[model samples]
Structures are given as structure tokens and as C-alpha cells.
Target: MKNKKWFGLLFFAMFALLLAGCNFNSSEKSDDGTKKSGDEKDGEVAQVLNLSAPADVPTLDSTKAHDAIAFNVLNNVNEGLYRQDESNKSVPALAEKHEMNDDKTVHTFTIRDTTWSNGDPVTAADFEYAWKRVMKENGAYNYMIATAGVKNAEAIMNGEMDAEELGIKATGDNTLEVTLESPNPLFKTLLSFATFLPQNQKFVEEMGDQYALEAENILANGPFKLVSWTQEQGWEMEKNEDYWDTDNVKLEKVNVFVVKDPSSGANLYETGKIDRVKLTSALVDQYKDDKEFENVKDSGIVFLRFNHNNPVLKNVNVRKAINMAIDRNGLTDVILKDGSTPLYGVVAESFYFSPDDKDYRELNGDFNKGTPEEAQEYWEKALAELGQKEVEVSINIADSDEMKKVAEYLQAQLEDNLPGFKLEIKAVPFAQRLEIEKAVEYDLSLSTWGPDYSDPMTYLDMWVKGSSANRMDYHNPKLDALVVAARGETDLEKRYEMLLDIEKILLEEDAAVAPLYQRGSAVLLNEKVKGLVIHPSGADMSYKWAYIEE
Candidate 1:
């Protein structure tokens, strides 16, 4: 409750701003004159695909990118050794073939001969450099916790040892070997993450800290090479002629624009300026009858995170009560009309490491369906323990139109469900919200999580001790112990059991965070656009296979 009063004041200030005016208009031009009829004319480049995202690119550095926008951009510019297909099966990308030792402690990969966009050979040393840099930099990346193969990675990251002592090594120019302290069943899946992506060591050193700050400093080893980036305008990528699998590549160019306003995004798509745009609630009804509307299950999940370090929210009963009070179904149905499904757990239902399993659902049962009576019971208990006659809670949220609706709904629900309790809502810009969350400046805040890798541990390990993403300061010794045990377990069944146990503790006892709903994206795409692949992880635009119809 330390910052509760300040949070309340900020909430009112934001609400006043919202009342002043909210307008979403499109400034992009229509592309009616550029439309073609059938197939691409000989020697002509394929169609120029225009795509828009709700958020701008957060960071170009793979190690620092923790959001969807940056991941989408990285997909066009970088490739991991392995790729996770739609079915969650691991397939080769930079690695043509691989073999594991008997004990599974060592993995040998046959690196495909590839060149960076700058024409430099992509060697095993690149991977070694990236792995060590992430551990040494100790930035915002959580790779060490997600990928358990690197020996002493945690200690090295915590300043206990030099990064050079890390276990990954290059056997030869084309061969690479990684030594893990113990067997990791999901090692291949973890490689799909950007944090594990290889970097050009020479380029990074030459550029110093500004290596990935712009399109010119970074080099691409993937299907597309970043050609240009216009801040707040858009980013463009062209096919890499030197890509190993260039024959299979489809699209020639991909243009991604930052269209935070849904109405404007829809307008841009309708006018043919953009190939695809995400739909908002206000426009969903309008586009429901349009044949071009396409909806897919989004892999992102939204939740409420409490600042456990705060004096008021530190109480277990208060957290549990708040979680019980939320009506997730209503939030999804009324507030977010973009086809999101209420989640009973943190992981998306479609997400998987192996083809047949959903890591989170198999472990933790669906999220708790909130009830007023249940919330009231917990609220009374919390009040008694705190010896307070009245309670007031403040929540911080993103200033997006959809998010504001959700926040207002929560404020009403909490006040009506729990007597003698008052609620305040603060809406700030997306970047500002992130800054405040990092500072731990609010009692409660709305946050989201998207898959960083294919494993359940990607979502579960965020709250592990001393993790940068653990903004809530939620510490559980048993949970921490299970996470460690699961990381080293080679047996699939045992590893799963450990993960399931951790999820059970989090949902049943710890209640460290509340699961809201799994997000779904609705896009408006021009009929001419083809070969577009939407991965749940939001990486891999797959534009190489796309061509414009003449």
C-alpha cells in the first residue's frame, strides 16, 4: 500500500485524459493503383506485403526483445539452428542435421553453410559468441533459465565465473558441441528462441553497444535482410539472395507498420495500403460480415501482477481475494471483442513442446473461475488480518482503448463484489507502463506474457528467484526447487511431473499471479496476399514464399 495513494492519483489523471478525446485516423495512402490481376509478371518482384502490429518494435536486439513486435521483426532478420513448426515439432534451419550423445549431455549439430547478410560466413563460433554474450551481458534476457544446457550459465550470469568458461564450444568450422550439466529433454525446442540466436561476433565488437540499434549495424542470417527502419513509421525487409534455402523462399519484400490504433489499422487494410491489419472491438462487428476477415488464436496471455514487495499486497489473502474477484470470462467477452478465450492457466491451449501435449494445461488445471461469494470470503479474512476497516486498491494499465475497457470492468467488479473496498484505475502509454512496472511503483498492474520458447518452463520460470522478469517478487522455495529439478531431469515423465507439481503449487497455494485470458488476433488481409504464415510464437513471417498476383 506504500504507493497506493500515488497510483490512485495517477489513475484519475489518466482518466481525465481519456475523457478529453480518443480518435483513431489513418494517414496511410490507399494502394488501389498498384493492384495486379493474376500472377507475377516475368522478372517483376512479388507482391509487397504490408502488415501492421498494435505495438511498435520494442528493441532490435534479440537478447533484449521480450515482446511480440520485436519478435516478429527478428523472425525476418534472424534464424535459429532449429525451428518449431506449427505442430511444435523441431525442424532444421541453420542446422541441417544433429546428433545427441548417449547420456544426452552433449549435442552435436552439423551447421549448414550459410552467410550473413554482410557476406561473412556463419560459423559455429557465432553461436558460441551469442550464448556467452547473453550470459555475460546479464541484460533483460532469461535464456539461462529457459535453456538449461549451458553449464555454469546461471553462476556466470550472476558474476560467479567468466563467460568464457561456459560449456558451448565449436568442434570445427561447421560442427558445434554443447555440454549441459544434465540432460535436457526440450533442448531443441529451447533453441527456437531469439535469446539463443547466433550473432556476428566481429560485427558486434566493431559496433560496440550500438550493434543492433539500427538496420545498418546488424547482419541477417535468415531468409530476409532488414533493408530499412523508420521510427514510428515502419520497417522493411527484402529477401536475402544468399540464403541457403533461397529457392524455397517466396516473398521478395515485407513491410511492417506500427499501427497501434485498431480502427486506423482496419482502415489501412480496407484501403489496400496494408495487406493485413489487426481488428479491434469497435470494428469487429463491421468486419464480421467481410469475407476478408481472418481470426487466429493468439499465443499471448494477459494477467494481473501484484507488487509483492509492497506492504499492502504482500499479504497472501489479499492476492488470493483479488484473483478470485476477477471475472475473466466477462473481460474477454465484453472488453476484448477480438476473439480472445478466457484462460484457466497461463499457457495457451494450442502451445506445445511435443506434438501431443500442452505443457501448461496438462500440469495446472484451467484458471479458477471467479465467484463473488468466494472473493468476499477471502476479502473478509484479509481485512481482519490487516486490522483495517476499509481497503483501497490501485491498478496500472496500458492506455490502449481495449485495455482501458478491461481496467474499468475490473474496477467495477472489485468494488461491487467486495464491500468496503475501493478501486482506482490508471492508464499510461505502453512504454511508460513497462517503465513503472520495472520500478515496482504500483500495488497492482495489468501485464502480459507471450511464449519466448516452446517449453512450459518459459512461462513458469519468470518468477524464479532473482529473475529479471520476476517483478512481483514472488518467491516460493518449493516452486524454485521443482524448477531446478525439472531442468536437469532427462526422463520425459519425471520432467513433466515436476513441471505439473510446480504449476499446481502456483495455482493452488502460492496464487502468485492471476490468469486472465488467452489472447487471439483478428486480422484483415487483402485477398491478393498469399503464403503468409502466422506462428503462435509470432516469429517467422515466411514472406519468401509469397508472390504478387499479376
Candidate 2:
């Protein structure tokens, strides 16, 4: 498609790069939400940062990490060949230098002289071990390597080949090589994500089941080392002195408070306990005039994922009727009120542009156009075929303050528009919700996906029948074939045309996932909190260059 390597891009969207404030030595919030200062550590002031995570990371094992929180955590703790910079572009990280073959099928990286938190040498073998581990385990993010055009990756995933033959090797202690089936222009960008991060073989083997289970079990090669984790309350990280670029890391410690309630988070911010707080609709209005309010339109879409194993959801008409009954506009404007746009398709607006230089969403247009009358007609057909007058379904959503409101609105909309349809809303912690959804044990679940790389394929690839992230068990021969073709397609225009068809099938014809809204986070941020860059894709945020302006 494009000639640029994986580390380069022709476009970069809006990124939240903030700068301000004096450094704090080690700050903690007491029970009443006031700062507890540790200004002196070993006779010197230790620069500290205060932050927040809405939820705790389910797992730190890079292979099993699927959510933004986990990605954000792993991204801070682990080093890969590259890392995304302040402008949301890929740049060198662990690799001191790199080169790609003339044909673009083979890439090589020279590992920099770095050591893990435990003082073990970081080598190319670590990368090889980590990459193969994901393929062998068939974890959720293994699709990333396949989509990156790694040779034999698809074959291995299909059981046609072994992971050992997956075209990656440790040529030497410091030399790593990767062979791709085709020239994937975004391969470097793909490498920047946590899924591609290296894992220490010895440490992992020693820890066994306990690897990454707690802060002490994990090792850090990047700028931060997770030091403490209290799932509900919060987590903490310290500057990794072992990092190759440790001289540049500013903050001595980073604190992430887990406050699920939006108002509580805002309260924590107002009390000087946290640096940033994600605002709810009410909080957004209250703080709209405040100098701290920021509205960042993300390249992620929050949607209702349909479980295909559920009989009602399996019926195309039923799915179509359900989508039509929900008012996406009302959900975003009234319920969310966070500048989010009603999502009509699975792919978000800021992800990719076609060869004709048109955003995929702009080119594809809205697909959810069914009216109430049409929804009722489809519902009737679904009932007749299923031989049922009433259908009951449960929607599992994360226990976030905003979602609590949205769940009520969804129940009201579906019940009001579709006769005899019952919707039960269930709320759980974000980590638990992921576990339940993986079992395909619910009729539907509220989920969101941000692009791992800036490509339409990132959105389209997961819905394929056997994809690890395809917890829905969705299978369409036509859609499957289109995705397979698009993954390997080198012609930009042709791939664009195919993705257009794929999106239509997914959003309109099959109605696999009910589009909800493209998320826009309105937050209360301290202008003085500098260096932390918020990305539209991949990891949600990066703090490598973070420092207090003071």
C-alpha cells in the first residue's frame, strides 16, 4: 500500500501533549483524599507524578493483555524495538538501530545495551521467546503478529504450521530478525505496541503461573517499574534506573488511583490528590469553563458486542431489530454528553484513509439507518422464525459511572421500541467483564477497541471466525475471505474497496456488533502535568518523556 515503513506514517491525528507544574518528591493520597508528601528520599528530592486508572489491569502478561489499561501499563514497564513518540509516531526504543531488506520482507534490529530491572541482560532471545510464546498460547493479541505480515503466522494460528517456523529468530545476543510474508508498511508501528514487547525467558520460567500476577513478579526494561498494585484502590510505579535511557526519565514515582466513580475522580483531582480526572456529563458541564477541561476525540469506538452463540443474537433479523431500536444519537448526546459521536460503523473516524485520501468512515458513510417501523417488521419476522413472542437478553457493562447511566437509557430504548423484548443490565468490574465476555456467556457486552496501529485492518481483522478477539464466534465465509484477502493485499485501492465491503457486511447486513458511539474523553487535566502524551491508538498514554516543568 504505502511506501513508508511501520515506524512512519503520512498522517497523525490530535494527541494530548501537556506540559506544566513543579515536581513532587513522592506523593500519596490519604483516606480523605489529600496529598501525603514524601519530599525527602535518601537526602534528595524524588520527583513524583500523580495519575489515575479507572480500573485495574486484569493481567500484565503481554500476551494476555487485551485492554487499554493493561496496554498502558505494559507499555510503561516493557521495552520493544520501538516506541511511539510525542507526535504519536514510532521511534527507536530498545533497538539502537534497525534496517529492513530492500524487498521489505525482512527486518533486523540491533538490541541496545540494556538490562532488566533484575539486572539481567536484555537480548534478542527475549524478543524471540516472547513472540513465540503468544503464538503457542494463542493469546488474544497474536492476531497482531499475523496482521503484521509475519511469515507463517496465519498458518501457525490455523494449526497448519508450528510457532517455531514463524519467521523470527535471534541471530545473535544483540541481533534480532523478522521475516514477513509480504511487505507490511506499518510493521514498525506494529512493533511499538506492548504485544510485541520482549519477555525474559528465565524470569518467566522461574515464576511459572505467578509471572506478572503481581508487581513483584514482573520485570521492567522501560522507564517505569510497577512497585505496588491494589486492584480497587490504586497502583504505583517507580522510575526504572536500569532503563537504557534512565538519565532522561524525570519522575521518580508514578501513582495511579483507581476511582471508578467519575465524581469521585474529579473530587480527587480537586483535592490535589490526582493530576488528571476523566469527567462525566455533569462534571463536564461544571468544569466546562475551567481552564483544565480538554475534549480529546479518540480513535476508539465503544459498541455492544453480540454473542453469536446466543440464539436470539444469531438471528440476523433479531440483530438488525436490536440495533435499530437503540438510539445511538440519544446515547451519546443525552446519556454520555462527552462530545462523543454516534457510531454508525465499527471502524472509527480517525483510523485510516483510503488511496483516494478519504477517511474510511467518511467514505463508507452511515450503515445503521433502520427506522422504528422497519425494526418492528424485522422483530416480527425474528419472532415467527424462532417461534417465540418474547426474548430476554442481558447486557454486561463495566461498572463505570457513565455506563451506569447509559445502561438505563439502553434498557428503556430497547423495551420501548421493541414489544415483548426484555433487557437486563449487569454491571461488573472491567477486568471481570472481560473474563465473562471471553466465555461468550452473555447475550451482549459493552466493549471498546482502539487501533493497535493506524489501519482499517486493525478494526476489520478481529471479526473473522477464528480470531482470538472474536469471542462472538462470528463466521461468514464472504467476510472471512474479504479479510484474508485484505490482510495480504498490497494494492491500496483494492484493499480499500474490500474493507468497504467488509464494513458493510459487519455493520449493515449481518449486524454483528451494534454500533454505539465513537468515544471522546472530556477530562480535567492540570496544565503543568507535562511530558505525558495521550495517543489516539495503541497504548492510551505514554509517560516516558514525562516531567514536571518546574
Candidate 3:
């Protein structure tokens, strides 16, 4: 997926108006099996939206949710300080009002009087507790470093200080104050992210480790609340009556079923069992001309993460050789025919914004792209340096249908292009694959990252030596310095330049990770479904404003 900033103010205003009419009243079912507005009543199936998920929700814990499926669900069931409107712009959600200092180093938010599903008032302390929890080492939040600019956040995450010493404070029940070590233009947008969503401090303490593990244990302060989650079977979310904007929530219930098979999902959509389904490459061509067919662009990049600690992969020459050998064009155009584009840089296209209104990619063009001969030369040098005739390495990948196809193609490409490298593919389930990455148990893992926000720093800062997402264990003092300097640099042009240089060092000079392609999804949505907002990054889709015409 790729992140695109919201532009054209007139366009967004019109978009908001289009969704403003989405609110549905307590309607009655007509004799023709259709909804009709009438007197308010309970136990009525006036509206219910059905969708299919490729995988089950791995973890609903706000701090631990790293997958798209979990993020989508969280986006609906939780309310943060802010949220993305119909046009992908951050707007106030739980926080009624927010103020930033002139230098943009400090922020103060006034929380609204919103009640949780359990009838408890949501307070500013909830936000403080949630943010502090993520900064602690025991939290293991994957994207904690994204907000490391918060004063003492780095110290808290690195165990240099207690989480209590972190920069956020609850000045009052409704007031939250945050101090940043450096200016961050995207901090408000970061607040709209799932990881930044607040958790009730009292409820968390009561539940302890069992918090967010089951549907019943969780509480919601957003448009919807989880009614049931049956693991692999499915989950049901009903509209939250206690939501501050419950009147704007149209759907009475959103039923999401886990269907791993694309064909099964397509069948469900066709048979009127599901309202939306994503198409596989096999089905993309078949449905491309249909009116309901929609291909959504995302600010996500898929790549190969080389474990720098791995014996054979520890060689820079070997890493570069693997980078040069893979045919990204073939991988995207052939193996992935679902509109995914080849990517040469770790940061996906259209995700970075430049102050001078110039394209960052134009300033710093494509990173290392080498031919077969160049790959062979590096492989030979690597073999000689390591004093090994040939080395066997495993490539861990998700066992999803699309992932399996890509893994097989990569395996063939490496074996054929780099002669001395014996590539072995290990395909595992999506949840197990994340565990393998966390444990650093794979030599080379097929991985993908969607930005937590629309900033270049979101993509660039992950490889800074000690980041939890830096599974490769890549460490370069030069690369680290550039990223750190970029974060504190207030001048937008200079900060972008620093980011470009950082990408050069990681993608070209050191070959810290291999870039493959930027992701795109081909989906079939029932035309009756409206107000379904698609984003370039963060949550893949938002159903807050969604409603069915039927």
C-alpha cells in the first residue's frame, strides 16, 4: 500500500457531504424485505454489512496489532484522539479540541465526554496509560518508535528510564498534555493510528494479561463494539449505542467472516453472502471489466529482510548479490498480476511529501538495480570471502495463496540467478510467520510494511539498529545518524534530503534489505455499499461512514 495526502479541499468537503447522508434511523423492515424508516424499536435487522477477511484477527490488542486485518477491525471498534475522515485527512475523534504550540513541540488535547461500551466515562488518563504502556520494553509494540519524539520516549523504550518518566501527562480528567523532544509534523496523524488508540487504565488492570485476548474482555468507545469473536470462524461487531456519534453510525452490525481462499470469498460475494471480497490474480482479469470491480492502491512495500546475524547472509556482498539477482519486474508483472508495481526503494512511492513541492523520488532516483552478470560477480566474491563452495539458506514466507506463489517465484529466481546459493523456502501460516520474524529465526524472510502514517520517517526509522521492527539486525552508524538527524530537523527540505540519503545507504550502498514491489489490491465491492473510505496507509479501510443502500 502507498500513502497519498488528501488534496483539493472542495473535493473533500463534497465527499464529507456525500457521507453525511449515511446515517440511518431506527427503521422497520417492509413486506418486500427492505428497510423503511418508522418508529424506533429493538431486535430489528434494519442494516447489516457483511465482509470477508483473508485471515483471522491475529491480535486485537491495540499495542500489538501489526496486521492489516487487525487494524481494520480496530479502526471500527476503537476511538483515538483523532481519526481519518472520508478524504483521508485527520479530524478530531475522541478529543473534541486540540492545540499545538507555535514551534509545534508541545500539544494539548481536550478529551470529550464519551462513555465506553461498559458505561464508564473515557478519560484523558486512559490515553496517558496507553501511550506509556507502548513505550515500555514489556509492551513489545512494533511501532512504538514511530512516536519516539515524545520527550523521554526513547529513554523509556530503551530502558534508560521508567515509563512513568515519559513526556505525556493528564493535566485533568479531560485534558492531556504531551511534550515532544523535537517537532513532528505528523504527530497528530500518528495519534489517529491504531497503536495510539487509548485503552482504559482501570479495565486493563482488572483484566491484566487477559486484556484484549477475547471479545468479551474488550471495551469500545467508537462507532462499533465487538459482540463476539469465534477465532477462525468469524466475528460480529454491533453498533455501539454509547458512542458519542452513534446517530451517525448507519450499520447496525458488521459481520466479518474469515475466508482464506480467494475463490471462496468471490463465491460468497456472488452468492449474496458477503458485501465485499478481494480478487486474486486469477480472478482479476475475469472481473476487471465489471462495474463492481475496484482496484485500491495502497502505500505498502513487500521486500526480503536479510538477517544480518545469519552466517551466510551476514556478508554484505551476499546481500547485494541477492538484491541484484531478483527480477522485480517479473515478480510484480507476472507472479503478482493484481496491479502491484515494482519498487526499487524501501519507501513506497507517493508516501513522502517535500516542502518544496518536488518529488523525493525524482531528486533521488531508483536505488541499486543490477543485471545477472553483476549479481554473479558479487556472489563469486562473497563465496571467496566466506571460503565456502555453496551455502544453503532458508526463505521464510507466509503460507497464504498469494504469498506461496511469490515465494516459489523468488526461490526459482535465486537458485537460477545466483549459482552458489541453495535457496530453501519455508512457508508458514501468517501468525507463525510473525513469530518467526520476532524471534529472528529465519535467514531471509519475505516481509511487507505499510506505513503507520504518511511520513517518510515511518518507513525510514524502522531500521535504526534497535527498533523492534528491525528484525534483520542491521546496524550502520551512518544510517542511524541520518535518520536521527532527520527526525529533529524542522526544515522540511533538509529533512527530506536526509531521508533520501538514508534510503541510499540502506538500499544501495549497504543493501540492508531487498525491495521488491509496492502493493495494490483488486477488490469487488457491492455497489450498494457507500462511504467505504480507502487509504494509502494506516488502516486499509474505514467503515465509520459506510452504509448500504439496500
Clashing residue pair totals per candidate (backbone < 3 A): 16, 5, 6
Is 1 or 2 the stronger prediction by TM-score?
2
In Å, residue 413's CA in model 2 sits off its true spot by: 0.2
Query: Tens digits of per-residue lDDT for model 1 on 262-380?
Result: 76666556555567777777788888877778777878788899888877688888878888888877887877778898886766776754334645575466654568899888889
Error of 1 at 379 (Å): 1.0
How would you encode candidate 2's per-residue C-alpha lDDT over 48-141 as one tens digit per residue?
6778788877889998888898899888888899998889898999989899989989989999999999999999999999999999988889
lDDT of 2: 0.83
Per residue, candidate 3 scores C-alpha lDDT tens digits across 391-427 of 8999999888888888888889888998867888898
Cα lDDT for residue 454, candidate 1: 64
**Per-residue lDDT for 432 in model 2?**
85
Candidates arranged by lDDT, highest first: 2, 3, 1
TM-score of 1: 0.88
Pairs in clash, predicted candidate 3: 1-298, 1-299, 1-300, 2-298, 2-299, 2-300
Candidate 1 whole-model C-alpha lDDT, 0 to 1: 0.74
